[model samples]
Target: MSTAAVTDKRHSTLRAASLPRWTPWVIAAGSLVLGIGISMAAGLDSQVQWGLIAAVLFVLGTFGVAARVEGRRQAKDRVATSLVWVAFLLAVVPLVSLIWVTVVRGVKVLDVYFLTHSMGVVADTEPGGGIYHAIIGSLEQVGLATLIGAPIGVLTAIYLVEYGRGRLAKAVTFFVDVMTGIPSIVAGLFILSLMLIFEMQPFGFAGSLALAILMMPVVVRSTEEMLKLVPNELREASLALGVPKWRTILKVVLPTSVGGITTGIMLAVARIAGETAPVLLLVFGNPFINNNPFEGAQASLPLYIYQQFANSAGSGAAFDRAWAASLTLIAFVMILNLVARGIARWKAPKTGR
Candidate 1:
């Protein structure tokens, strides 16, 4: 062959020899089997643990092998990128499955009676007892909690992000952080102790107080972050127009971050809404509906679930009620989130830019 013809033949060979883009991903997937073998040898108890270990090992082994075989850095990059997507899917599947299970199992017992009737007369296995009293108690307690906690949390957040400085702010921030990490049981105990000190007996309002304590720090931290995200220019603009500082904050800063603040408050509400320990400690569930939170025992959702689940009565009806109450609690949180979204959208200030 002539020199030009020989060069053309060499180029053709190089082009034909190039590996496909998908080769690294295929290699990574193959490595998953090898990883599973390794995990099996390790003798871990959980299948999920085995699968996760296998996937991770597969990616690493694939990366090294692909890099060596291809003799290039880019080969390893492609393998790593594909492995991330695989990992993401693996994580999402479990969460979706959990939600599906909760919904499917809980919806079976859902009815108007479930929403309106208390479990007072119904035995654990009794077919007909509804969760009306618990539902009402949950609403009342959480509503009161929201009323009490939101203002305290929002104001604390404002201080922390806006005017807070020096030693006092730091102390407040530290205490808030500590409060956030306090065990739910501890909060219940703290309230219990306080009530005892005051010679007060257990009541629904006391339970609401405990929930407020648990919720406040969460609200403060979330709202503080949201407030900080509000642009300084908005505040400066208001000040430039000769508006007073308090009014500027009230009108400009708060409106700008109202959506986020509302969202934080809703999230705080959700966090405390399901707490069983505090309610169990502070307010014993009653057989009948107690409208007066200050005076007597009240049925709340979590407490109801516990009571139903703990007691064995006529049939499996208690379990069904527990599931139904769970579903109701989940629905309430979902509704609160939706309402927060609506308020955020409606009240969010118009961005001039």
Candidate 2:
């Protein structure tokens, strides 16, 4: 035989057979049908069980077919890929279901009228109330908490990362770790106890303080991580140029990590926005519009939703309003996240190699 022909035959013989891309999709569809059929035969009612069975069947089918056509190594690789996809679906399915249900139920009563008006005189059993007051209170309280928490968090993180030493840094870090795990209710109770001592009435700013407490630890952790990611070379270069340590941090270190710090601040804001315990204990959930957060009781979205559901007993109007309020809170957090992402992208350091 000619050398060229021999080489071609050898290469062709060594090449392993691979499955078509559509093979997985076909197997998935078959697995789904078979899983449903088996569930029906077993008289099972759970959709979750059907999904689990389908996922198992899909992975098994991929392994079996690939092992038969290709080698066991290729089969194992395909199985791993199938398992990853299954796990991803398992995680995402529940989130999509929740958002889908919220949208379906919330759209019934969420509109311009709902957004513009307040609960006012409408009873929980009645259908005419809105979340205007709740929106205002949530905004003010969360904004105030952000104002209180963000600067302190950034400064603490800067101290820990840049100038930390000896027992002081360890103590500060230990406290931050403890604070991160502190329950939202505990923070609320702490503030509530202080309010009692000072004879302070429940007001919007009181809730803000509790929220700020919850926010600070998260900001500290996130900011610390971000600051650590900044290369030491940059700091050394700045110091070599005769820049003071504080000035180097303010001008270079902060600007380099500003994107991440801003994102952390926004995440902390979102974390506190939906808290009902502190607001319930402090703000007291006002029904009427209270534009001044520092002076009066306020109605946050969470408190409004909780009140509606708790007081309604079985009222459909109250349930609808609760769902609508939940949707609004979800939207607010989502907007904060989107804004954070935008700011992070905008402020991210440019790279030119």
Per-candidate clash tally: 4, 0
Instruction: Give me the candidate number with maximum TM-score.
Output: 2
Model 1, which residues run further than 4 Å from truth? 1-61, 71-83, 312-315, 338-353
Task: Encode model 1's per-residue lDDT on 1-353: one tens digit a residue.
Answer: 11222235333332221346677667666767776777788887777777777677666766676555544454556566767877797989798877787688788889886776766666666677788888788888988998999999999999888899999999999999999998888989998999889988778998998899999999999888888888889899999999998898799888889888988898789878889999999998987888888888898988988887787452387777777777888888788888877877776655555
lDDT of each: 0.80, 0.90
Ten contiguous residues minimizing lDDT sum, candidate 2? 1-10
Query: How much is 313 displaced in model 2, in angstroms?
Result: 3.8
Residues 167-259, model 2: lDDT tens digits: 999999999999999999999999999999999988999999999999999999999998987888999999999999999999999989999
